[model samples]
Target chain A: MRLLLVEDTQDLAVVLLKHLRQSGHTVDHAPTLKLAGGLWSSEKDAYDLIILDIELPDGLGTSLLKEVRASDVAVGVLVLTARSQIEDKVYLLDVGADDYLTKPFSLDELDARLRAVKRRHISKPVVTQSVGPLSYDPTNRTVWIGSDQLQLRSQELKLFESLIDSNGWSASKEYLFDRLYGLDQDASANAIEVHVSRLRGKLVDHGLEIEAVRGYGYRLRYRLDE
Target chain B: MNDLWSIRRRLFASWFLMLILVSVVVYWSANVVVERSLREGQDRNLQAVAQVILDSAVKIDTVIEFELPYQAFEVLAYSAPERIYYAVSVDTQHLSGYRDLPRPEASVNAFGALYRGEPTRFYVGSKPIFPGSTERLRVVVGQTETSYQTESTTIAVWIAVAVLVAFTLLALWAEFSLRHALKPVIEIENDLGSRAAGDFTPIIRQVPSEVARLVQTLNRTFDKHRGLLEENRAFIAQATHQIKTPIAAILTRAELLEKEVEERSRDSVKDLIVRARYASKLATQVLLRATITYREIVGVREQFDLTTLVSSVLRTMDPSAEIKEVGLTLLSPEDTPVVLDGDRIAIREAITCLIDNAIEYTPALSDIEIEVYETDNEACVSVMDRGPGFTIDIAQLSGFDTSKKDPSHVGLGLAIIERVAKSHGGRLTISSREGGGSQCVLSFAVS
Candidate 1:
């Protein structure tokens, strides 16, 4: 995950930067809110999360947070506040902060918060989702059973992706074929059935079922035993 | 002086004493004037009778002839029953009744005479027979003072009654007016009494000018007190942030170094990290406790849900529990929330301390249950941990004493919990739970 840490304290920031880098994350450090804002806007698309310190040398980190949220960027913001006053925390949470940590927080705790924020971001797409042991990642076009990616042909992957987008509703064969192949490519209606059969075999042990709606297409549902 | 401490009593006593003094002075002067008037009236009556006797005297053929004026004596008898006498004399010869009656001295025209052991008022009058007849007749009349004494006593009694009436009215007026005058002081006392404990808000109500001074003094003290508290709170917050930041960096840096160091040096670095973390924790708890104490002095409270607070705290602690492989769970009633009135920050800190202690002591992968529910008209939060149960009696734990069954775990957490619970009209109970564990319960009344 890529992160921006906005902190004025140099030593604390260095330690946090070292820990984040050692934990296999790309982190950028900003010693002041002005620099933080500049870096955030110039590289807005590059960051997946922001660890914001409320007490900044130039401006309140919350203002920067507000600017980020106003720009409608889908990045997670985790606030760090020195004072644990509940009202301020509640206000920060209300204003689109994903999470907050009080001062003197452990590096492990910071990592955990980063993971939770990322998970929340992932859950927001609604189309790509994970339930029990089944996960569908839309960005990478992969379906994961537990930690292992399910092996599927390109056409089967497209068909399964269309079913997940249907969100528990049946996907018609015409819709599945349109999604599976581009306009230049031609596919027969029976081809959707072949991909569905093969995907069902692969999903046998996973906690999911590809249910056929008679005369229409297939929908994905969790297996009841799970 | 002691008697004057009560405003009501002092006002009444002074008013009563003043009324009595004025009444006595007025009564005494009035009695003296009445006595003088009565005596002058009796003397005038006696002089009239002597003139009548002198008018009746006449000299004929070398001897003076006279008739006693009985009508004058009859008029004197009307005031009260009393004896009367008269005498006529020319050249020291007594020629009329009651010759033993005393004569007036050469320089005195009227005098008192005692006759038959009864006191009498007398007057002497002399008249020439004709303008130049060379013969002078003197007459003296005397009367007992029974009627004069009776009239004086009656008048004195009337004066006494008037003074008594005046005193009574003054006393009643003093009692009612004094109470009305001291009403503002009572109001101040009542205002102070009804305030919440430790509340330092100024006295804003209007008061009498005299009592206004007291109110102003109190308000000044409250302002100073609030100022001091605000400064103290700001310092604590700033100090804690400053202290915690460096300590956090040290611990994190040491941890980072621990990973890169060789195996033999890694252990020592790990120990350094632990000590740094412990130092940071102590600083946080001590400062947080100070913050709580200042807030308690300010005495602000609001109503909130203990269930919601407990659940939120548990969620915050979830990551920490995961690091230790400990499962922290909250059990609460679904329908009724554990709603209570208190300072939310203090309560949260107390609960945090309890759960933090449990997490530190309990072995990894052990379960710690935080149960919040209402029972026996009380809202309770009980943290049960699968740590080694208390070796010493739980009731014997003291906040000041560092000595404990587990030397590493001083009783600071327990002490803070107990203090908060007691301040909130709640109770803290530490007991060894069934089947090998310890439970600490903080409870407050529902209503």
Candidate 2:
């Protein structure tokens, strides 16, 4: 991941630059808001994320964040500030900060938050996701249970993808139906149950099952042994 | 005791007292005037009747002749229902009427004396028997005062009754006017009574100018108080906010030095970093305490779903918990939404403190459970941890308790939670679970 660090304090900037770089991220540092803006324009499309500091030598970094957001660039913004007041943090978030970390934050926490923000933005082109022994590849449109590839109908594949994307959280039947059929297509509610039943039959004795959450929808449950 | 404080009652009492005094004075004046007028009127009638008798006297051929006026005597009886007496005499002569009637003093035109064994009015007069004759006829008229007394008494009593009735009506009017005049005062009292605590909004209801000055002063005081609170809040926020940057810089420098230092010096560097972090935490807590106090004076309340708040707090704490190998879980009713009114930030901070405290104490891979649900009229957040519970009853520490806190804990977390709970008119309870853990419950009213 590539990130831009906007900070004015020399020692703090040095530590962060070294830490972020050592963590395998390509990082560029700017010591003032003016320089940060220049760097942003120079490499507008280079940075996947920007770590903004609120107190900048030239001006507030929040203003820069707003500018970046206003532009068409698709980069994540994580605000770093010594203003631990809830109102200050909430204001930054309201102004399109993807995440906020108070001053004196641990390096590990900062790294985790950056990764979380990256995950949210980069999940659009998900290549593979696995739940228990079941792995699905969206690019190749393939499904695997353990070492074996499972053949599934088109609607079954759609249902499986929806359930997997829910990440163990139950997905409502309405949500599943919308993903299965396009809005313009006329489909009955019974069609979902049919596809779910067929999928469940295929997974019988395979240590994986679709369990119904009463009054909600279905969730994928995993077991080590059947 | 309450009436002493009541402006309405006091005004009514004062007006009614004054009206009663005036009524009594009016009644006394009416009695005196009626008695005097009736006596004067009776005396005039008696004198006229006596003059008639003297006028009827005639002298013929030097022998005086006297004629009694029966009609004149009869007219005297019409003054009231009383007996009439008349007597005529020449020099020492007695003629025509009751002889035993006492003669009045010579210069007295009318006198009140005992006549016929009852109080009576008498008139005495003299006239010459012939024109310019030295000889004169003396006449006295006496009448029983039964009727005069009755009529005078009746008039006086009626006047007194009228005055009394008028005064009673006047008192009622006075009471009503007092209430009407002080209506604004009563309204102010009622408005103050019904307001929620710390609600110092200006009195917007229209008031009389007399009381409007007082209300204006009260409103100005409230405005000043609100201004002071805002200033205090801003100062505390700014002071704490400014404190953080240097603290952050120090900690950053310390961490950087710790990386470059030898193994023997690393412990001391790490110690310095911990102390710096502790100072930062203290500053944050102090700021939070000041904010809670300020909010107690000027609260910013909004309605939000309690479950959503809890879930978000859990998510924010998850990363830190993961680094410590601790698990944080939320248990709440999925469909039953617990909505409450509060300052969301303060509430979130309080929950975060509770969960963070648990994470700091519990062993690695231990579970910390946060449950949010509604019970009766309250929304409850209970955090249970399977950690070493406190030997002393933490719930017993009411306000600020730093005596029994652990060495690593600053003891501000519980204080912050307690202050936030109190500001919301809520409660905080801590108890050891029966099995082997501690549970802290913070509950707020649903209103």
Candidate 3:
């Protein structure tokens, strides 16, 4: 992944840039908002994510964020700030920040947030989404749990994709049926139930669950107890 | 003073006293005038009757003889029902009717004296029997004053009573008007009474000129307090940012060094990262405390669902828990919302602190169970961890205890949770689980 880091703290910036590069990411560091704006205009499409610092030498980073959001390029923005006020967090999100990290954050947490941000704003064609031990590759339509790849039939894969699209919210049975079998397909109504049960059994050990909603459909959730 | 009278009462009291005094004075003057007028009319009739008798007296040769004038005496009878007495005397000799009647003294035309055991008024008249004669026949006409005296007393008493009644009505009207004038003041009292404790908005309602200055002064005081509070808040925000940014830099640097340092020196570098992280957390907790205090002063309260709030906090803390290989689970009542009325930010901070502490203490691969439940009178959130239970009495724990066994535990997180609980009319209880773990319950009153 390519990232643009806009931070003024030299020591922190040097360490973050090194740590991000070591994590197999390409990064460009800018210490001021003016320099960040120049880089953004020159290589706007080069970055998959932009790591922005709120307080900069030239001006607030929010101005640059607004500029980036206004432009045609759809790049993910992650804000880094020392201010942990709830209002500031809410305002940053409202200003089109894809994610935010408070100062003194651990490198591990930073890596996690970066991955989460990338998964959320998947403007690129190929991206992998990982939840708990489960990872899904949208490009190849493949699912992996740890070292093992999940085996699912074509119809079951379609059902899993439909449930994942709900984002932990319940998807109606009618919606799942539509995704599993199109209008011309001749499949029994209970065929969706059979596929869901099979998918649920396979994912039980993968820290994921497909819960059946009464009078509705199904939702995918993390099986935290296990 | 406890005994101090209100302004309305004071004004009404003074007005009452003044009105009573004026009523008395008016009554006395009116009585005097009415009695005098009645007496003058009675005296004129007596004098008229006496003059007729005196004119009727004519000289018979050289002797002064006067015939009693019956028609003239009848005029006195028409005035009021009273016994009449008349006397005709030459010098000190009484010659005609009612010889015992009191004589009018010299140079006195009308006099009051006791005659025939009754209070009577007398009129004296004298004239010579012939022109230039030194001998004058003196005529005295006396009438009992019981009738006219009773009439004048009745009239005077009625006049005094009328004046009293009129003035009493005027006093009552004055009281009513006074209350009407003080309506705005009463309204102000009610406004202050019903106001929320943290409401510093000005009393901008229209008031009489007399009370406008008082309201203005109150509004000025509120403005001053509001400005001071806002400055304090701004200072806290700026100070928190200033304090945390450098700590964040140090922690990040130490974390990098931990990875690059030799195996033997990695522990020390890790320690440096921990201390820096602790410092950053302490700064955040302190800022949170100030914010909670400020919100309490500003009375920021709203109703929110406890379950939903805990779920959001869990989501934010999930990554951190995941890093430690600790599993976070939420067990709450389905379909029913555990609602609470309080400062949402403060309560959220408290729940976050509890979960953060759980994540810190629980071992890797262990589970942290957070439950949101409501009893009959309380809404509760309990965080149960499968970690080593408390070794010391939790009640004795304070925020900056240096004597703790663990150097990383500053105890500020628990302090913050306890403060939040108390502020919401709730309590925080930390008890050991039946097994080797701890359960911390933060409960607030349902209201």
Candidate 4:
């Protein structure tokens, strides 16, 4: 995936750039709207996704988003904002953003959101996987096995969904550290261990194959071919 | 000022007391002088009356040649009051002309201190009369001095009334005039009291010379601060937008880099470049906040020369100055050294930021002229450059922080300079060269 990134903090940008590149994607970073406009205009379909900051040194992301929409461009956009309220999220999403990620977000969570957005429109089919009758719904949260509805908390469901939604790459504890808990939360790499143990127990009783990353987080492994 | 109230109260009290004292003294001296003159005049008239009666007896004794009539002298004494007495010391027993004289011991001695063994002061103009040459009669006529003392007491009462009237009028006038003159000060105090609560209203008053200039400056200062507050509010909005831009860029780029890593594309080299751009923006924001906070504090002042201060700032930034090849020079030749009374550290920071701005904005190897001079009782420090100049009239607006909106000109530096200038009773002038570049000048009252 290709994206347009507009950030101004050096330390934060360096760390974010490292983690996001490690996650796997292409990013064209424009420090200002002026540069971003030039890049956007220079190459049609140069970006598969537009990751814009609402406040640019030169201008706002709303205009950029409007421009993207007016140009009939089909690129998915993920807005980054410091604001963490539901209204800002809704506002950005309404203003042509495919998704919204607030600041201090985990790299893995950001990666997951990107992948989810990428899965929306593609040359290939949307892959929906399951763990036994503990079926997973990426768009919804209910999972059932053996005619019995599974009861799981929101974070537990998120942990399972993250592992299954890794698109087959092994999910690691370090990756889950950034996802399961808020990056600004008082959580560590061990936080995944606590959540994964709970999730694996529920799925194993239902005859699912959820594997550990061995000193890392967990991964859900189940196929119908068996 | 702490003692000023007490001082005024003392003046008020003393003025009332002294007026009363002065009036009393004037009335006292006048009463004493006038009464003495009146008593002398009354004594002279009484002596003339006794001489006339004796003259009538002496002429009759010389003409008729009969025994000079003692009856006539007696009748003269009878006509006068009983307090009057006439005594004749003769060859016979004392021929008297007294109805009843006050006893010699009781009477004030007519001859005073000289009368003990001496003749009685020639009667103070003696009227020694003859009774057909057989005896001599001294017609000493005087009312007892009790009635005279009573007259003097009445004169003193009049002086007391006059003095009372004078002081009462004076007190009324002094208090009335003082209150009227100070009414403006009271109004100023009321206005200042409200302004103390951050009202920022212009004072409406005309006070005495001592307080007039002070009140005017206070109102002007309020207006100045109010204007700056308004500007700061605008600057805050502008700053929020500026800060948000970089934060948003970092966020959006972070998400973008994730996408690049997920695909494992050979062209993922582009992701690192994207992140570096946002990293520099972070630096910009940190500097921006530092400058804003440095400017925001209510600045203080002390005496310091700009030459030494600017040199130190430049020395710390020498490497950067060298990198830009912008020569920084401090050219000042005045014993009238620039005296600044402002927040030394904050002002130094402001100056350094400005110098840094000049160094960064100017073209490489271009001359950056920094000079300090004394002008119009003010110390002026100017940093001129051959780089791109400001677009608008920054000096005229008196409040426009800066016209340049370059990534480097976050406008924070310009705002700080303006704020510091105002604190030191001065202004910042930013004028463009006719051809190119800008001249940024910071003015301060030469303390």
Winner by lDDT: 3
lDDT tens digits, residue span A124-207, model 2: 334567666667767645676655667554566788888877856468999998998788766655767767876787776677
Task: Report iRMS (Å) of candidate 1.
Answer: 9.8
Tens digits of lDDT, candidate 4, A1-226: 6677766556556666666666576777877788888888986477888777776678878788888888866787877765433234446766888776655444544665665455443332134345556555454354555444465544566777777668573587767767766566565434566566656667676656567767755667654535
DockQ score of the complex predicted as candidate 1: 0.16
Model 3 stretches astray by more than 4 angstroms: A18-26, A72-74, A106-112, A122-135, A138-226, B1-3, B62-87, B96-108, B111-122, B130-132, B140-181, B202-221, B254-282, B285-313, B324-447
Q: What is every candidate's C-alpha DockQ against the true complex, given to 2 decimals? A: 0.16, 0.20, 0.25, 0.03
TM-score of B chain for each model? 0.77, 0.79, 0.68, 0.41
Off by over 4 Å in 2: A21-24, A124-226, B1-6, B55-108, B111-120, B143-158, B180-184, B194-197, B204-220, B255-271, B293-299, B333-336, B361-363, B387-400, B405-408, B411-425
The local lDDT score (0 to 100) that residue A201 gets in candidate 2 is 70
Candidates 1 and 3 compared by TM-score, better number: 1
Using DockQ as the measure, name the better of candidate 1 and candidate 2.
Answer: 2
Candidate 3 chain B least-lDDT 10 residues? B392-401
TM-score between candidate 1 and the true structure:
0.73
> Which regions of candidate 1 are displaced past 4 Å?
A84-96, A124-226, B1-4, B55-78, B81-88, B97-122, B129-136, B142-165, B194-198, B206-217, B257-275, B293-303, B334-347, B357-447
What does the lDDT come to for candidate 2? 0.79
Q: Estimate the TM-score of every prediction.
A: 0.73, 0.76, 0.68, 0.39
The digit string of per-residue lDDT tens for model 2 on B83-133 reads 888877788876567878887665777899987689988999887777787
TM-score of chain B of 4: 0.41
Q: Model 3's CAPRI class?
A: acceptable
DockQ of candidate 4 (2 decimals): 0.03
Clashing pairs in 2: none
